[model samples]
Target chain A: MATIETPKSQYGQIADLLISRIQDGTYPPGSSLPSEDKLADALKVSRVTINRAVGLLRLSGYVKVKRGSGTIVRTLPVILRDAKARYAARMQGTGAGEVEARQHNLVSNTVYRQIAEVPAPEHVAQTLDLKPGDPTLLRSRTLFANNEPTQIADSYIPAAIAKLSPELRNENAGPGGSYGRLSDIGHGPARFTEDVTVRMPTEQEQQILELEAAQPVFQIWHVAFDAKNKPVEVAKHVMPGHLWQLHYGWDE
Target chain B: MATIETPKSQYGQIADLLISRIQDGTYPPGSSLPSEDKLADALKVSRVTINRAVGLLRLSGYVKVKRGSGTIVRTLPVILRDAKARYAARMQGTGAGEVEARQHNLVSNTVYRQIAEVPAPEHVAQTLDLKPGDPTLLRSRTLFANNEPTQIADSYIPAAIAKLSPELRNENAGPGGSYGRLSDIGHGPARFTEDVTVRMPTEQEQQILELEAAQPVFQIWHVAFDAKNKPVEVAKHVMPGHLWQLHYGWDE
Candidate 1:
């Protein structure tokens, strides 16, 4: 086995080197890692240093350690979040009306579209304060990151609001998307709340995102309200779980 | 091929049946699943109904569906959450030299604990307004739901607050135990704010939680505060991604 060839306190460096090899398909997932003693001898470092480096890798979710078995390489995988502001802008600007503001970060494979349909899920109906099987417009997309499949987002708008725009039905055409369409129709979200949950990838999710067996994904539910604080839309994103690190900072 | 023999609308029920079989070692992880046609035939249902049932399983991360091949059983996993209330009450009550309040979920197998230790991570230090590498007592726990590992938590507290009780270290002697000692110490959390993210499980996490290859876990970071809104402690929990659904309802 190729050993970690570096000095102690060089844990990050060693980790990066190993991770790069794995990312580049050198040390393929499930490959056995070199023993710490062997790695230290080859790297000209003490076992303690190798241990720390491996420990960091383990903590970061890169490698697995088994007592009877040896260490094994693990793939770096996660979800892609379209909940970012850029995505919101992309959906709106691409649809209709004079695009006053341009949204950037449009990847080649990304698909954006608006579909008018009835709300199918129970949770969505409750959020929109509509009965089950209620009419709703579903604006959706399958997002990609670096040409890799990422997320499937479907946002539902009440039929009453959706009927205001006959242009919203076009697969790729709607004024400013739903957010913009809502504004164009004289309604804008004054308040929005987001609830996020992490769970194992559903089978369809695993296939659509092509995630490995161990990868999970994030399901983010975003509800937007108009000036009257009436819930207007609920956007649900089934995100791939391998590619995000969320950071939240609060002020006192 | 065992088709869903229950009510058609009961998606979760079928999923639970399959999950229990897998969990109890009836069909170990990575085992092939019966074909939709076969299952439907066995259960005297249409393939459409079987597909819907299977779809639910796939969505919840219970099974994998391959185009050329067939469906495969998935692993039902657990989450790891560190409860901080146990420690919060102990630390605060001890500081006031008063009896502490202890809280536990009504469900059996739910548990809590707290301890004192130096915080180490930069994020925790920044949140607590402490210098890097400062001494802080760390209290944490492994939460269980019905004797199954739900989450593993790690919490950090400033040493100044921890020194209020001298016998804190000895309390952690037993593995997977913490709440009782916290009562003796008398500290409690008055408030808590949580920041959560969902993603794929790292290799280290997979092993710790005994997770299967396809399962992901959620990461929740919570910061507790005292009655005066002073920062008390920061806790991190790793929860199994597939089994959790977080709910947040806000009224306008």
Candidate 2:
């Protein structure tokens, strides 16, 4: 485990040494690190120093400490967000989330759903070009990646458009999710603008997502425009930052 | 200021109301909100509740509190990452970071620079197809937006290629930055892959970026490939998440 020389700072040195080992695959992801006492003895450091080093690793998201199970190296799930593939999936009657999960060899499910006709929130109203409090169909769902809650997504569409398709009112928006149903009604998204921000999760969000105290949330606001450049659907996603990486590629 | 009816939870309700106001432009970005005492009195809540609500807002990136200044609405600088524009900027001998800053009407400056020849980290080595400890040129700089430290960019290029262009070794990286100089030497970035993740900032990062305690950092790992699909440069950017929003648009 000790491949590199220790640094000046004791605990930091230990942490760096451990991180190097982890990176070099001496300890693979989801694998447990040695016990604190064992690590302390191996590194010729105090138990307190080893504990502090482990704490640093946990804080930086290199590892996670389970209550009874010991420390395990963290493995983040990567979602390849290919713009063209995502749009093609929507056209083929599959939700982009489902497509992403499938690409990662994971099953995606909607763990929770709340479909209601409510007053549009100010931000959503602005994106949809509707006045605040205007009636809109709000579909809120918790998307799970392999049965683990991964994101909270809320989509808003004008009440008129939502009424045109019965599928839009159900949890399974037949085939491609909302976009597929919208297309059935002669309105398909032609373009998308995604705005991503990061912040600490709220108490409620932390509970719902089962996020760690130090985990921040990625707030993605996606606005889809129709062929005519009119906003058709506005969605917001709050995803636990530590569990996910958003990957995108482009040609120069 | 209280346009909506308060919910059952006092502080949460107040926070929600305040957030609505902030979203609707009642409290514009960079404008200070009323004092705690004033907010407490207006919401008919105790000062403790008002303080808690304000703290929530701060954590959620809606506001920031300075030592003497009251809570001020946060204004996230938008970086429109247009693929064509970014690639064009790089081809025309301008760094993409500079182009982004110019679009936002802000001057981009490199406030810190560390150039060295060192071993490539495991990830960078893999991306660059180099053996660990193989010579690589590391150019690390702290990029400032209008004098505010916003990002720490670290670029790793193979020492062989880096040595071909003196511009790659210097702090200023004379016009068009490393990629432009790389083009002069017949190796230009033709493709790019960007991976974005979010996490809490370390103590050292917090001080370097002057980030708030609750702020998270966006870590972006970018790998640029040349016409032959060979990875030419790998870079990592750590940006204070609360102060920046990454925007990208795509057609369906």
DockQ winner: 2
Model 2 Cα lDDT, one tens digit per residue, B1-252: 111222245777788899999989999978999999998898788999988888778766788777788778876565565645766787787877788889889888775457888899999998899998788999887877777787888889999889988777777687677888887888888888878888766656766777754467899898989999999999988988876777767778
Cα RMSD (angstroms) for every candidate in the order listed = 11.8, 6.1
Model 1: lDDT to the true structure: 0.59
Runs in model 2 deviating more than 4 A are: A1-87, A93-95, A102-105, A212-214, B1-87, B93-95, B102-105, B212-214
User: Each candidate's interface RMSD, rounded to one decimal?
Assistant: 11.7, 7.7
lDDT of 1 by residue, B90-113 (tens): 443331101111122213232335
Give the alpha carbon lDDT tens digit for every residue of A1-252 in model 2. Answer: 111222256777798899899899998978999999999898899999998888777756678777788998866465666655776787787877788899778898775467889999999999999999999998888878777677888889999788999778887787777888888888899888888888766666766776654567889898999999989999998987776787667778
Residue clash pairs of candidate 2: A93-A175, A93-A176, A94-A176, B93-B176, B94-B176
How many backbone clashes can be found in candidate 2? 5
Give the DockQ-based CAPRI class for model 2: acceptable
Error of 2 at B172 (Å): 2.9
Displacement of the residue B177 alpha carbon in candidate 2, Å: 2.3
| Number of the top lDDT candidate | 2
